[model samples]
Target: MGKTTGFLEYDRIEESYLPVDKRLKNYKEFVIGINDSQAKIQGARCMDCGTPFCNNGCPVNNIIPDFNDLVYRQDWRAAIEVLHSTNNFPEFTGRICPAPCEAACTLGINDDPIGIKSIEHAIIDRAWEEGWVAPKPAEHKTGRKVAVVGAGPAGLAAAQQLARAGHDVTLFEKNDRVGGLLRYGIPDFKLEKSHIDRRVEQLKAEGVTIRTSVLVAGKDGLGKDSKVTNWANETVAPDALLADFDAVLLTGGSEQSRDLPVPGRELSGVHFAMEFLPQQNKVNAGDRLKGQIRADGKHVIVIGGGDTGSDCVGTSNRHGAQSVTQFELLPMPPEHENKPLVWPYWPIKLRTSSSHEEGCTREFAIATKEFIGEKGKLTGVKTVRLEWKDGKMSEVPGSEQILKADLVLLAMGFVSPVQSVLKAFGVDTDPRGNARASTDFSGGYATNVPKLFAAGDIRRGQSLVVWAIREGRQAARAVDEFLMGYSELPR
Candidate 1:
């Protein structure tokens, strides 16, 4: 609304990236967001849509238009306030979230949408530079102790909110550091570790007790491939946590990666995306690893085409793999979406990430039939093309072929949280293996067990970081209400 004709006069200006040659040499964040002047112009492009679908599109329900107007008016301080009102970690989402808000932008119907994400990135970065980001310690103490089991987006958000609501929150992490997936799963190139470090300092300044390398449950409770990569110094039992804390919130993310059951999966050089990604993160953090999984000088094939797969592609390129190829079982999506049919909603369309643009061969409508290996090690993969008819896929006759590969990375996504953790806590789980909990406004997020609750990927399965933050904030409010019989914290 800052400029009624702004949309017509301006085209979307996206963030810039370093050239591939320079960026691939090191694992560091390379996205150069729009400057303040450019951000103001981008904000001016927000139209006065009677219904702001972008608000509903965002998982945290950010007041997009208000922030846009504020930025256009050059009120940078107020812009951050509006942003923080809904999103606890704009810096994280601004950097990593797939901006569904843009997809649901009304301006995107007939033209490019407002650069909302870039504006957010600019706003938060500016806020930090201007020293506006400070710890908000509670004025009063409620004397309630809460245990947040995971240090990912959800647990961090919940811990921050509960601490702000005058509760004594103790955040526990199995990893040596906070930030569950953000710390390890994501490559350093997309998100630098320094971002997480500053937030950890802020959390400590806010009176939240941060414990690292402490597993609430012993290692035996984890699934076979679900070993947390971080070094653990101690293990805390569930009974001790229940007895010590007034309430416990489970924010442990879905960690059980879906496995490829095809023959020869037990072969060497075959690993889960989690297994491969975390090692590189550890190495980036100055931890030298022996026998670390590397794609160097190997024909690397990454299964499952998604964010994790893209990450593998990027990392493999950085590792100087001989060749990199990605495979998607589903048919390739359309290059462009039918906007009229799917306006104001996330549409299914082909998304080519920066990793994809770097260098890799992508194969769609293909499935791995078997892992081809000799002498008990991976050598290649047998594959077959698929044909879809009547909403079902059938293997094409005589379509089987073996593709050369020396290393295979399974990025097929997670199935559920490790069942052992849920079993240890005795929390009920959904059929899909996620913690069972509701999102209703009344006493929601509470699990079947008394004083036990769940949030984020542990409750909702694998999802975007923005959604995890929303759930964490809401869960914190729920926990606060349970402890104090009422809460003023925003959901």
Candidate 2:
């Protein structure tokens, strides 16, 4: 424990950000990370409770207490080490993760939980500034090659781990740059691309080959002329991949956007959240997006109240939208959770993101029935109020309403992995349409196809980045075990 009574001594301190007015002008990271002294005080606040539930809380099972102790002592280097021991990229999660660990903190029952996430944020930012993070190449080569598809968090994590295990790892991405969802799906205002660029540099230094603009199985599914049409590499079929590489790991994300098939769905203004978000990211990266959907001088209605929806609200506001409204199918949850009942588990509660704070009209228990449009473009949305009974939701009659909107974004979340990618590999799939792979020690993450393994969103469906990292690390160990008779990679 950092301090005997640290929990009682210090209160939770929240991170600060630039004013919304100033920050909305451009897409840049606005959170001001804490300094070393502030971090120490925050670390000291960690009771490091015996039987630390924060470890269980975190998806990567980070050694929260040890890192807290290290930070409390101002051992910045050791703190980063401890943070990195479990999580491959604390910087990513430090900025974006919801921090279930805090909800699981034992101190949270009585007082505010320790600011473990902020502590990690401070530690990583400091480590990067001090040049402590570097690439560590393997001492000897295993002479085995592994191909990882997709360049998202899961793929990157698995690739990095395999590289450290002495295997030649080649990562393939259809996009122009690596960092799948992290690079494009996320808005630059939430996470900058520089973080991903630096990580790519380190991966290169560690001897990992990243082939951007490369497709693993076939031509760009987006067709001959895509928004990212510039990405064109030699096609490498999955069968050829199996013949060339010693093993193959599929870490593609769950990208099948759940669509609303209501009337007027063919309207020009309706787009998938993925379709809308990535264009802005590309523009922020200096790519021109001519005729891209803009909310400027328009009223926008974003369906779904999750992170993606919040992102749309933020982006639309930044685009100078005249008005923005968000609709949630489920009822609004309580502001606070019943701690005693849900202490060690993530709870259902109200979560107002930074985007919500920016500017938005939020509605709960509202469901969209149809998109009203004229001349094949969206004009408004027909919606109705819903009520829950016996855990089932149903719309209430006579509660219907019309919301004028110029553009609509479907942010209802993904259904599963792209079927074309999974079908290309001919891997077995679960009932939920995810790759079927066991996480047992004996089989590791191997799929029904021999020497083929799956991880991250491809295997587990849509999930948090931290969970993706955990799966990627474990999958690498499994692959290493399958490659050799034994393995030493950490779980």
Candidate 3:
């Protein structure tokens, strides 16, 4: 710890965001960077407890205390070094990550947790500005070629790690650009595409070959920003990939959107959240749409109260939607969690997103009955209130009503990774439809196939970007061991 009584001396201070009125006008990053002095004060707030639960909270197992100490002492170069030792891309996480590490902080027991994420953001930005961040190519090549299917977080992190391990890595993405969901799924205001572009540049310098629009199995072209390269027609069969490379890794995202099956499901305006979110991102990137769905001058009903749903609210507001209402199937959670019961673990509370803070009418304990429309166009939604009893939900009698709606966004969540790709590779899937892969000590991240491996959403279903990076790093270590009979890369 930098200061013996640092935790006692300083209180946690979060980074500020641009005002809602000003930020809503354009899709650009709004969070302001913290100064060096502010970062040191925040780092000093880290208790650096004997056992850092923040590490456990972080999916990549980042050495939080060491980085905190480095930041407190104004050793930003060392801070980035410590951060890079575990996380491959702190800039990405620093911007969009939910920062579970702060939730699991020791100080959170009574007071606010240290601003670990903000300090992390400050450190990495300074490193980049001071000319400390650069590509570190492997000293020697292993002469082993690897084809990783997907350029999402998992695929990119795995490719970078393998490239650093001396393996020739060729990452394939069906999309026009890299950074899987980051490039298109997330809105530009929350995270700019330039962050991903810079990383792609750095990875190329490090010897990782990125083949975007090179869909591995005939997936749709990634509609994204103009700076990305498109190569979707190019594909590598799973078995062919296994034969060509010493080892193969599948890290595709969970793209199969969970649908809301109900009457009038075929209505023109009822669409999945993924279907709507990506289009706005494309438009922001200067793509013109012919039959694009818009919420402008219309009341919109968003089903599912998750991050994706929140995204819909933000996008709809920008489109000049007359009104936006978000619905959740479950009953409302308490405003705050029972800290003693949930401390050191992710809590289930009434968490709100920045989008929600902007403007949205949220409804809990509700279910959509049908999409009401005429002439095959959605006009309104019929819904019924619900109540929970004995761990099951039932619609309340006489609680049905119709809400005016020009668009219905299904943001419930993703069901699983696309099955066709796995089927083409003949990889077995779990009951939940994720690719079958074991996270065992002996052969971590290996699929049932001898030389094939699976990681990220392909293996673990829809999950956080941090988890994808962690698995990618671990899978790289595993592949290195399988090839050399030992490995120096950290798992």
Per lDDT, the best of the predicted structures is: 1
Residue 5, candidate 2: C-alpha displacement in angstroms: 1.2
Task: For each of the candidates, give the backbone clash count.
Answer: 0, 0, 4
Tens-place lDDT digits, model 2, residues 414-457: 88887766777888999989999988889978998878899999
- Candidate 2 lDDT at 471 equals 93
TM-score of each: 0.98, 0.97, 0.96
Best by TM-score: 1
- In candidate 3, residue 371 scores what lDDT? 91
Q: Kindly indicate the candidate among 1 and 3 with the higher lDDT.
A: 1
Query: Which stretches of candidate 2 lie above 4 Å from their native place?
Result: 218-233
Whole-model lDDT per candidate: 0.93, 0.88, 0.86
lDDT of 1 by residue, 91-134 (tens): 99999999999999999999999999999999999999999999
Predicted candidate 3 versus true structure: per-residue lDDT over 403-480, tens digit per residue: 998899999888888777777777899999999988885888888787888999889988888898998889888888
- Displacement of residue 21 (Cα, Å) in model 2 is 0.7
Candidate 1: Cα lDDT at 182: 95
* Candidate 3 colliding pairs: 175-222, 213-231, 213-232, 214-231
Given candidate 2, what's the lDDT at residue 420?
62
